[model samples]
Target: MSRPEPLQPVYQFSSAQEPVSLRQGTVEVDFNNDRFCGMADLVLRFLPGPRLVFHAIVRSTSEPELPFFLNVPDNLSVSFNGQKMEGFRGRWKANGNTLEFDWIPRSQPVVLSDMQPKNSVAAIFHLFNFPEFRGGNYQEVAPLGCALLVLESEDWKISLQELPEDATREAWDQIKNEGGCFLTHMVKMERKDGEQFSGEDAQEQCFLLDNFLSFINGGRCWPVCGVGLDASGETTWETFASPRPVRPPYSWFNPYKASQAELLFPLFAKRWQQSAEWRDCLHSAIYWYVQANTSGGSPSIDAAIILAQAALERLAHHYLVVDQKVVSGKGRASDRLRMLFSACGIPNEIMDATPDIRRANGTFKKDTRWMDAPHAITDIRNSLVHPVSKKKLHDCHVDAWKLSLWYLELSVLALCGYDGTYVSRLTAKYVTDSANVPWGKKA
Candidate 1:
């Protein structure tokens, strides 16, 4: 019988030596660089085509003496199962005191049926745990000719070798007693035809297969399992079932809004309801019309004028709401505003009036250089809702969009006889206090 050839070597560093021993089929390499500690593992598999995977990790012990130094090879070459991999490259990155290199093979379906079980399985496990070497230590024992023993504290333990026809019951009991956590890495070799070795014997069992080998090789824990349990303490392996859904807490009233509105509305309502700046601008243009239509100097006329002006100013603010939109296209701000006005009982003629009428009766303006806040707001809103124009938006310009939202909110409060200043204060408080909230998942 012809012996199976050893798997090919795919990675080697210029300043490193191969490991003194292998735990699984993997080989570790130690480099001479003071700035880095590195290792490599080799993985071999038979069925899905003969294959090899190599992984390495480099750690930085201290800052580099020179900004540019060659601690790693310029290029890497890998050969697997008699096939040469072209352009095989390794990647390295420095993270604080450590660097990592991942070298992937260029070819596919590299089989490993003929390789000896001890070397093949060991290499596969080493490749799987390549990612966790820095924070963890690996322990391995190689038996004379049959099996290899490997373990990592707080991680896992594994044994790889061909099983005997009569594996001792004591051996099985000892392994099971050792926490039933150790995984068996195995492969069976059989011939192709009748009177020849039947390959079916080599097929792996699903449960016996370590589903976490890839992650373990990558130096990470296995992902959460998806098994479900029933009340009887037995595994409830069902195809489909509805999960219990959680509902958010509900209340008859929104306490946060109620308390906030009550605390702020009365204090600033008058300023919002009747701003001197808005009244002065509108009174000059509409005073005569109001007097002619109603009794001059009547309090009712003044109140009516104020309500009408407040409504218009609120509408003007609404016309300028801006936000980031992923897709680009012309925004229908004008059409939407017209529809809103019609719904609010405002006539089309009033909606279509000249800027002067808007400025005099509402807070809109035509030509003024002193920062037309409403127009600036409208431009931002259009930019967000419409297609990105040739114009580039800066950080300050984005801030303007937020300001427009705040001001619009205030305008709404004012129209509703609530204090607008309270909205500003509450917004500032919420934003400041929210900074302490944790934002992302822990490692």
Candidate 2:
């Protein structure tokens, strides 16, 4: 395992990789063919951070004497390398003769073709911001339904089985720490003895794998693009963009290791198999969890705390009333949550373990108020939602937010039946080592 090259979030499939540059093109600047128009020597660069940069030298085409600025249209058509590209919704500015445009894609994922099936397909994709393995070698990480998932080396290359002599802690850091994409993994689905792999099955399984990885890594871990090869030798290219925010740099919450993939992913696969309803419930849960913890632009902590709490309540409802039939769903929120944690074998003293949260609770606790984790959390949440002129929001708002997220993460992992080691965000300031999950045998 030599030091891996840093990956840019943007790259072309061809030889001209990140910051893919194209020269010599034109822009259509008028609505009518014979009306006002402009041509430009265009340059487009697909830069890292998944950004697009457009630069052009403009000149009037319909009226040669007209100023270039006058000829430039508010909405222009783009063409580069003899190909017209659509969806260039960006702001354009002119500085003398040069016109420039820079744009970032929207946050939502854009899947070109909905789950079209392909029988017994092999899918190869590059992972974004994924961590390196301990051995720094090619490994089959997990299985998704009938599909086998393998984690390969960077740029679709397979590494030697043995770890490189120079492998170090620094080598295992995620690629997004710098920027760019690397580490191509594969999903191979084969037909069972007499069964046929449906056309859309491969894509469906890949996205399912994506959600699970994103949840475990506590960030946006998605395949930017991939190629699919069917058993019949038919090849197709799959392109999609999920431009969600990655994990916060300071977040210490359960940095999922490649080693846990085998143990955890199978459990997730089993959960997904339950029913469509179960899948929907899990997806909703993951969405809220990601929003609470990983949204960009300095998301509101008050809103995030509320989101985490709402997710925990939803999971508790599904697990207790809908799935397990353990509770009648008639109780105080904190009591219900206590029952939920008890059922999951999570310790109730998590607040005590996190010194920041504990100290925050002490600062505002009145007499016997906020005696424990659940009470403290709910009380803080109430303060945020139902404000009082005399009641000041806790200065430890971030601590409470993280505590709720910790609870939510544990609950979700337990729901998936995971019994692996996890780094506790609660006591991470003092204790940085990974520990067995609360319900795991060692714990």
Candidate 3:
């Protein structure tokens, strides 16, 4: 008998590599720099704030201690534990491509010192700690990685209850303006003889780091995040980062996937970049999707429907009014829908889920056909925004809301240029997932 094919998923979550021990915490970083023929053993540790500790174990037959000169940006000052060192010094050779220096202390073989960022600089490393780091030190590991946190002197830790809005803005702006965010780096030491191999594994880890840190640097970090969960319902101050993969592991269950959004968003953004009538209206609509997904109540439901109506109007306006270069003479929701569907119809595969487009075209226009659902939809939208107690909506339900949103999704998909399995997948999940429905499995 032939084996049945596995089900396809819409999108899979990203998975990351297992963390290697870095002192007490686990880090995900790449540290195999321009490898120049030799075993350069290295152990890196992050000690809160701006302190970075590197333990390089290289085979002997040279000077007792060599100064490591790194061509770091001007604002940073390196130190041996507490005492500071000049960036350009004789003992530490800063000439040529190499930045040679001894991280080891005077009378101690165990070099436990720090490389600190200067006054105007703040640094962070990629130290991911999930289940505590155990079973041998990072000395035995092949991959090298570390931590990277936000800049500014604990500006990420201010009491929102006390700080004024202007002060908060000032602090945030100053961190960026003074060029304080550049203070971050990683030092790689690969043993030249210990099995020379291409550093393939660390490639993904490096990519993941850059991908996430870019978002955070662009002001995406949620201040006061829930770091841990105690059964007693308490919290901790540590901004503890845990293991996170860039993308989920590939499996046969997920056949193939790509974003349909890639094709069309550029068109909308480019065309509407300068027009406030189009721009702000589009934002309001998208934000309503967030509210609809997150908030629910009688009044909130009304607000969501109204905002969703607003968003849908803006998106429809993208192709209809904007593309046609016309005005909303009648300014009716049905008029907009007629123009929108005419301009950008639903994706063919999922067209069965949305029949309202028929009403836009068919002569039985305002009758109770699925095509006529727009009139009812607009009526409900008007009642929600400008309420009337007597007007009942037979179309108002969970699936109806899904249909409206899915219609918006389809319209967006149409604008974005998508007609693929993703459209069918969305149909299956959103439209047909409900039991006993016309498009669902039961039907």
Candidate 4:
């Protein structure tokens, strides 16, 4: 009988997995755990406007890595976080060496669902590579999501298939149903309990929460990943992104609370973390400004303001100084303050037409009573930085705080490539500059 033909074993989706179930069903998946398969990456189907499909790229981990092959039946249907996440996608191919996915929510316009972005914040790539793309820094952009995404941390490529020009939007919309948006999974960072949060590089975390708060006020809430600092500055602590799922506010006007909300200090807490728009100098500068503006106890007035001044100093020395390599100069920090402020933002068409600020040109058809906060905060900032503690001094603590904040906010706007009413409105909200001349260059 030919030696009974030696028997060979084959793998299956599961030794005993289920057929299919939209609700919930027991499916015993007996796959190799050491193979790196997990519930988070479980490829499932969700039935929506008919049936939304999700295709997972499966691969094996053994030495001779094999493509993970599972015979998924056509009738296979499943539900995950929810049906709204029907377009929610993810991938962990390349033997777990690579990870990324895009999620296009069920919303017609394809917005991100209510899940705090992790490892990195979520954003639309439509901004780049579009007829609408007007160039500058920032990709030239001011991404509203986590800045870590663009760094060399991962190799991202646009493998999108070619499409007819007219079908661009329609084609992308189609890709979402196949799990495009859910490609990149935002993982969390954890540290030992005693570990102190890095104070200098929490720019992304701070701005994310700040923007979240601002968005919520407008009735569109978005969750933010955050970090916390220990008052004692001692503890081997483990911290993760704000695990709190975003929901409606108990008090919309005042939603951000330290004790109540899920606020966390960022793990990417270094001056090195930067977005395309804000360089290292700007990143550190903005972070310092956030530290000073934090709630609960007032920010260290002297320290915060001083750091703010130093940030501007660095900005001028590194970014604006005509001598690109020179770090020092003859003038004091204050003497160079005006020069930096002069180069704060470019004179764009929209800024010219703004109501009460000096015009870069005749862009402003008319003028109103709008005067900018004086750009000469250098003296006050210097006073705080180089203090004469012995002498009982007088300075508008509130004004100094406001001044530093205004300076930082203006710099942020410039980086974002935003100007006009968008920035003007933010100025009113951020620094109470309601004069509509927030971008007004006061040299």
TM-score per prediction, in order, is 0.19, 0.67, 0.35, 0.33
Candidate 4 C-alpha lDDT tens digits along 317-346: 655454344445666665455555556553
Off by over 4 Å in 2: 1-17, 20-48, 51-88, 91-117, 135-199, 232-234, 242-257, 294-297, 325-331, 359-368, 389-393, 428-432
Model 4, TM vs. native: 0.33
- Which rank order by TM-score, best down to worst? 2, 3, 4, 1
lDDT of 2 by residue, 205-229 (tens): 6667667766766655665454455
Candidate 3 lDDT trough over 10 residues, lowest sum: 153-162
Off by over 4 Å in 4: 1-240, 243-278, 295-298, 322-330, 345-376, 389-393, 422-443
lDDT (Cα) of model 3: 0.32
Residue 353 C-alpha lDDT in model 2: 56
Please identify which of the two predictions, 1 or 3, would achieve the higher TM-score against the true structure: 3
Q: Number of backbone collisions per candidate, in order?
A: 25, 9, 33, 34
Best by lDDT: 2
* lDDT score at residue 305, model 3, on the 0-100 scale: 60
What are the lDDT figures for the candidates, one per model?
Answer: 0.29, 0.55, 0.32, 0.32
**Candidate 4: minimum summed lDDT over ten consecutive residues — where?**
6-15
lDDT of 4: 0.32
Per-residue lDDT over 145-168 for candidate 1, one digit per residue giving the tens place of the 0 to 100 score: 223222221212222232222222
C-alpha lDDT of residue 173 in model 3: 43
